[model samples]
Target: MQNNEELKLALLIASIAMLMMAFFVISFVMYYQKKRFEEEKKISDIEKNYNRLLLDTALNSEETERRRIAQDLHDDIGTMLSLTKLSLNQLSKMIGTTGDEKEDQIMKKSQSLVEETILHVRRITRDLVPTTLERFGLLEAIEEFIDKLEEDNNLVISFQANTEEFPRQGQKLELTLYRIMQELVNNAIKHASCSRIEISLESTEEMIGLRVTDNGVGFDPEKIKENNLAGLGLLGIESRLAIVNGTVQYEKPLNGGSSAFAQIPVMPIAENKPEPLHPFRRERVNI
Candidate 1:
């Protein structure tokens, strides 16, 4: 009887020990899973924040540099060029040679050089800051731009305006659209064999659409995809649209030409929450 009782006790002890071991193993596994999940989550959040900061900083820095360069050209270089032209005029008047063709030639050369300088400075300023876009909203500026492109590039640029006003898109979106149009027109002039190109804009309640069509010797999308990537002009347009949460499609239209279309978000983008305003925060540049 005593031996049987001891055997039963030992069996109970063994069972309890096994149960405790199982419980410990399960607890360890649960802990490891939780820790792994937390680690991954932390990594993901860090990457997301890093990307946001990088994009914002890049855009902001670009704007700052543009403003600075435009101001310098307009305020400093423009004034000097004008003053130099005036000085040349005064000198020509003082050195009055009685109808000397040689003097006239020198004066003409100076005048031409001065004109070129002024024109170049103006061009640089316009490129840096589209004063028209700021003053006359987007539609009028676009029309004016097309007119300039016609005179400057000698390319038959056609633009059809579907909307007279686009108030909801705000200045940022309008600027992007204007810049993209400028880029497309430039690309057409440089690469597209066709002289005529078409630009159209349509807007609905939900989104805005832009179409750029060229009657050029259209290249296959698959074969020339490498060229498109290498130039980065196409990639640049893609990136800009992406910032505004837009989509771009490249195709050949029924008229036997290449067409690129973009649709962008019209509604306001969601605002991100600012990082915690801690007392220890410093003017530390993010590397």
Candidate 2:
């Protein structure tokens, strides 16, 4: 009877041990499940946010393009039509041309107007189709952009390509970079009020860096953020660089002025130019 009691007690203890073990296993499973649930939730949130940002960027890009097209049309075609109308009006006013007096004078004025309009139209069309970018490559295209800036703004610009060549990359990325540079330089002229602009492009085996500097009234980045939100020029640039897997950083010089630096990881190349591709059909730029 005593031995039976002892066995009963042993069995009870064993059962209790097993029950505790089972409880622990259940706890562990519940903990694991909860962790997995949290991880998946976080991932979902990230994906949703990413999609939202992409949509916003696309819409903004479209709006910007529409504005640019409007500009080209207004600057080029509108100018031509206005001059043509003026010419015709001048001719109409000079009615009753005796021999070659008024007719010659009116014709001369009209010819001059027509010539100016043609030149304007051709210029706008060429900007729409800068075949040089494909035929000449990035360096040459940059030089041309600089020359055009000088002519339009009367601003002195200096540029240097330290790598001697640009690497093979997605066309969109290249175009984005070109536009970024253009935007940066344009902003300096319009707002910075700087007399000189310096540009440098350097590359390493795994990365390329671009720096544009101007000795102008440098503003604090933190201050700018507090003052404005959407209208910030560099904000759009930051978004644009992200689309190309690149970065843009702002630097306030120790002495004076400001510098904008951008970098992208890329394999280095030494060719004088990239392989020719189809011409860059100028998308009507956003204003």
Candidate 3:
């Protein structure tokens, strides 16, 4: 009888010990899995930050190069063209219609060509750096751009802002927004076969929003994403918006058109801050 009792106790103790060992093994596995997951997440976050830094650097470098090129065009080629135009005017005066109709016509055409070229250079410089964006705020700059686009093309573009008085966001954010707008507009023009576009800009306490709606053949944003079929224009817009910590969404309106909406967080403007300078008000001219 004593032997039987001892055997039962031993069996119970052994079973308990087995259970304890199993618990320990399960706990270890779970702990190990959690640590592995944490390590992978950390690595992923580090890689993402590194890539963002690289992208930011590349974009900054590109902007620097743009500024350099714009300055060169404006100061050098622009000056030379102006001088050439002046020289032509002086030559025309000196030759004074000595009954040489052909010579006079040639001089007039040469002057016209030089004037057109000068305007072209100015346009290029403006596009490269967007001096209007620097001097005026984002709204005015975008309006100026739209005006130019309307003057050149038959497509009608309508712009609306929440207010006439828009507070100045920082230069970097404004420029990024402007570039994104340009990309969206260009994409619509190039691919959408749209006749009319509606653009809206709104500013609130926490965020700035831009929406562009076009009456054209719409696209499936999800399909584009799944197939990795986004063109360079879409990719460029995404990259620019990402730099500014902004987001963009593309959707097809029920009315059978496409719309792109972008939003960026911004701090509330200080009332005491001075207004932006609109030194040279951009005049709408036929390009």
Best by lDDT: 3
Error of 1 at 90 (Å): 0.9
**Residue-wise C-alpha lDDT for candidate 1, range 54-153, written one tens digit per residue:** 6647755665566667777877888899998999888778656567778878987998899899998887777766767766666777788888778777
Winner on TM-score between 1 and 3 is 3
Model 2, span 1-287: residue lDDT tens: 99999999999999999999999999999999999999999999899679657944784576446445645665667676777777676665565354567577767777677667766765665564444555665678779888887888767899998766665444444555666787788778877899889988887777768889999887676666677752546876776666556787778899787898988777334345433332233443221
Over the stretch 1-287, how does candidate 3's per-residue lDDT look in tens digits? 99999999999999999999999999999999999999999999899788777777877777666767777887889989999999999999876757678888999999999999999998888887777887877988999999999988888999999988988887667877898899899889988999999999988988899999999998999999999999988988888777668899999999987999999999444455433322232322110
Q: Each prediction's TM-score against the native?
A: 0.75, 0.67, 0.85
State the displacement of the C-alpha of residue 9, model 2, in Å, after optimal TM-score superposition.
Answer: 5.0
Considering every candidate listed, which one attains the maximal TM-score? 3
Q: How accurate is candidate 3 locally (lDDT)?
A: 0.84
lDDT of each: 0.74, 0.69, 0.84
Summing lDDT over every window of 10 consecutive residues in candidate 1, give the lowest-scoring window.
278-287
lDDT ranking from best candidate downward = 3, 1, 2
Off by over 4 Å in 1: 1-49, 97-99, 224-230, 269-287
For model 3, give the 10-residue run with minimal summed lDDT.
Answer: 278-287
Model 2 whole-model lDDT (C-alpha atoms) = 0.69
